[model samples]
Target chain A: MEEEAKAKPRNPSGPRLCCVCNTRRAALKRPKTLDQICRECFYEVFEEEIHQVIVENQLFSPGERIAIGASGGKGEHGLLSINLYFCSVEDSTVLAYVLSTLNRRHHYGLDLFLLSVDEGITGYRDDSLETVKRNEIQYGLPLKVVSYKDLYGWTMDEIVKMIGLKNNCTFCGVFRRQALDRGAAMLKVDKVATGHNADDIAETVLLNILRGDIARLGRCTAITTGEDGPIPRCKPFKHLFSKCISRFCSGVHQGFGKNKVVSSLTIRNCGLQKPRAILDIIKSGEDFRISTSTKMPEQGTCERCGYISSQAIDRATKVIIPGWKWCKACVLLEGLNKGLPKMGIGRSRGLNNDRKDAKGNDNAAKSIESKQCGTLDF
Target chain B: MQLTLEFGGGLELLCDSVKIHKVSVEPQNGAEMLTMKDLLTWVRTNLIKERPEMFMKGDTVRPGVLVLVNDCDWELSGQLNTTLEDKDVVVFISTLHGG
Candidate 1:
């Protein structure tokens, strides 16, 4: 296949040899002036229908900092990386890719990587830090290595083992999520992008739906820009399938990050076989589209985490709902309101009158209607 | 056979007791008559504003509330729709998110 690619005069437009299975042919190609990756690799990326993803949600605008969680895994093939850089070449230059990795002891990969043109960390996080250094020279962009232990209180190995896989998924996810944002804050980057491949997105959607996680299931779109939260994160690969992404990634040979054929996940080593891992039970909805399976629920914040999670404030805000029993944002918010009136006005707006209006009514319908500060129909 | 039902948010809004099943006492008394779905429906229709979208879809649902179907998180059984037999202990407890 290598000889074939070299032997034949590259038709500025023909499919090239695959990046992973060099035995097969790629399905796509890059333009002569754009990047140096093959077409097949292009499809394997969330880059396939990028315009649709962006336009549907109106993601990009002037002065937007697109922060990317560069896992450097099977998710971020060379084609997707370079293409993403090229797409944002002009107006959007502050591309801070958050390298969310685990304890090197866990042996996930990318040790002491140069995050920038030549920037590498001295001790812990040296490998991934070094990769970011190399990325700077390779793409001539800003790179930041985000560490998880500093912010989340545990490394992947420590967390997975202690919490025991099933529940550890949430721990790993929450830590890495916050870790990226904290890193982005350090770098002073605004928006963020992540290489969450199709498989990852689909699995999450399925899991959310299975658990009746109304909030997560609905908002897991290809491009979810966060509002009422810090640093909006957008995903361009939310809709494509894994096979296409794999097909597209296979043709990527040079220039950008590697790790194309590794497993379609970063949680491979956590040895997940637990009851809550979702991967075990949430089967892929073959021939299913995001529109068909999801019913985007209303948007609200977790009174604990303050992150853009399910926007359900009613049940979650109940007295019996427990304070620590909310989203990370909700929990934080609840804590902040501790020792003070839970609801009423607080220099911003007053709801004491509202609470009084429904007091003693206990009628679900009337209370709901009055709670809204609007007219009641039913 | 008096059972206590400690709901999440709305429990405070209701009286100390309500006649759920033939048992004219607390929710715990009619543990067999009540369910996660039933409790949710009551909350949706009488207490809260919206609805609990995915309450029971076989094994797909995670038990959000700490339902002691005999003093154990329903995660012990397939959550959400776990059925209750005779003398089954159904106690609605609290939930825990993160730190």
Candidate 2:
């Protein structure tokens, strides 16, 4: 050990002090600002930044009923859910201890509910929901679970078995968006708050650009979306970084662990530089200006379900397609019920036939001219 | 030197779901002190049973994996260059699991 010490080069700099407090030893370096801060100071700055975002954006009104979308894991996403809820409340003292005392405090005036989607992927979702259920009791929030099996009569496990893994995400993604809306509508909440952090928004911006989805690209960076829909949605964590969310989640989970309530909050990072790049993408998305002459798709209600959609409705099948005016859900259901799972999937002969007629008859065909199977809107 | 390593955020899945391991490690190539860089190699070799890529990439931990030394972020201690002491508690939490 002495010989090892001799061979090792001494660190040029000793322990540095926190940049914010200027006293305590620095614990971590902030990626956004590159500030070296201690744990206590980091907590303060992190929570304060979130509070500022909420106040500046007016994310919620005092009496509005809000539904928090939660998925059980390491609790990072759940931490965002709880943090946003707590931040909206007027108690600064309780913020630090919110996780432990959330069940007992009811003075926030806002009705908050935990909404989770069960994809019915067997072991994966089932195990995660256990953590969600535990969090429900721990936080004393009412839990509402909406499953794919109930909403669409198809579990992901069954869907994967039939569709294989190739485009399973497409089915799951489309189903989940509708399921969340249905769940929120069932709860009768005034608004829905999802834990979509900065990184997530950035990724969507990049994806929208890659797919040349100018409409979604413009709306993806907005803090609140679908305000005109039945249930308006907002992302309170839209400005917060994923790393901070993970740290906060772990901190809260550890704090509550002594009381024997395990926190199963799981977080996935998409790499370090990726988030910075994502922010740049969001900036680019914000600065984008679509030419006025661009023929944008007209927003219309799904003829069958009355949900707002931008896709053309199919006249014959009553499904949403290029020449049709039905939503993807209605079309997929029609396909499934009629034993034609491949009906709207890829570039099938049926779709080609529809396109031929669409080109001849309608101008809306241009909107979906390049649309492929599984690439339709959620 | 003897050390305690803890894994969280589904990283334990790579190691048979074992969250913690106590093991002894020595500096490689006749070095006197063990830095986090060496410790990572040791972990990849002995601890990670499969999918080593999940834990490491190009001689360092894959981005998004948080490393803490003695309850502090490894960034404070120079990351891979932070030298280890006896009985130091190191934590490896992967933030790569689905939220």
Candidate 3:
């Protein structure tokens, strides 16, 4: 099938026959092995390696429904707010292609669906959503889109308008956490698969370490997370590189350095010079042990939405909702809806003023607007 | 030398959102042949509309970008040292974006 490409006249560097097959012209130099391999061999090994990861990790069982978190926003560092555009179209498209192919070839018996969260970022999400829609038809997998407006009654565009860009990413990151879970639940999927590759995980490790986020630091390297939640998520590409995934899909776009917290570009530079550094970072992160005395946030269900949350209900919010625990998303939405906008962002603050507003004003509309934040609406 | 340049995966955004460009370039200093290094200088000066740093670092493209010449990975070729021929197709894709 690739004979036509072989027939083309050789360029100045000449045709290097594939190292693995000793036939067919080498098309790429792999970062992992530095092997010059042909297109066919590259595709085979790429798929096989991912298949191996799935099998070894036991990411799925037969007849389980899986949703691909078809957003480019997975496993991002610092400026996660705009990661929605981080290889948004290509990675998701490739994930859909490879997962569907593996499911059939390996008889994984998985019902795969593309689940996307529409943050309503106007030009950004609008374009990627179209690509995912195309992938739905191309892969013959069903797609379910959950939007911010439908869930929280406010789009990112509207949130930005009110809160401005100062802390909008905080709002975005928190919202997407719940949005993906809600989307998966709507599809009745057993697990969710994200296009998070080794590079993203490595960067996340470095980012978490830098910020002293010991909790996420420990869990960021896991192949799958949120096991106790309503829907768990896995990363099939966790062992893969971002370059291979984008190249497999046929193109790559520049992810400009946007995170002020840390430059992911610098980490990418390390990967380029030494590809093994990515895996090494993940290994180091995995080996990290938290002392017994260190208080890790306990995972419990959000009383409002019934989703898993690490945060306990604060006294102020408890007074308002009366013993109902609010998850991060609900807290952020409660802030947005109540016009406080800073309710659960950054460090936990005294909602003393919050209680005062609810008690003095007796604003039933604002205080009782918890209906706009829960996952049950879907 | 006449060359066909194509950008994708967001490099097109750097070049005024135009993905393909047909351009003619001449070797600087009256050199006998045009190499990719010269072509890159030409592209940086004439094509890229914004964020030149995103498109290039040092004398070559930024680390994460992939370069293909005549549909073959540039690494198979000589990369920046590879000489350009008439109507040769050179593709630059930035693999740095999402995931």
What are the lDDT figures for the candidates, one per model?
0.35, 0.61, 0.73
lDDT of 3 by residue, A256-310 (tens): 2111111234667888789989889999999999998776655557776777643
Poorly placed runs, candidate 3 (over 4 Å): A1-14, A72-87, A251-263, A310-324, A349-378
Q: For all candidates listed, what's the TM-score of chain B alone?
A: 0.40, 0.97, 0.96
State every prediction's TM-score relative to the real structure: 0.40, 0.79, 0.86
Model 3 clash pairs? A86-B98, A87-B98, A253-B9
Reference A-B contact fraction recovered by candidate 1: 0.00
User: Fraction of native Cα contacts kept in each candidate?
Assistant: 0.00, 0.21, 0.38
Question: Model 2 Cα displacement at A269 (Å)?
Answer: 10
State the iRMSD of every prediction, in order shown: 24.0, 9.3, 8.3
Error at A234, model 3, angstroms: 0.6
Q: Model 1, A219: alpha-carbon shift in Å? A: 1.6
C-alpha DockQ of every model: 0.01, 0.38, 0.39
Residue-wise C-alpha lDDT for candidate 2, range A220-311, written one tens digit per residue = 77887777877777776676665666666665563211100111111223336544654666678788988887655455677668875333
Residue B89: error of model 3 in Å?
Answer: 1.4
lDDT of 2 at A299: 59
lDDT score, candidate 1, position A372? 20
Model 3 chain A: worst 10 consecutive residues (lDDT sum): A369-378
Error of 1 at A203 (Å): 2.5
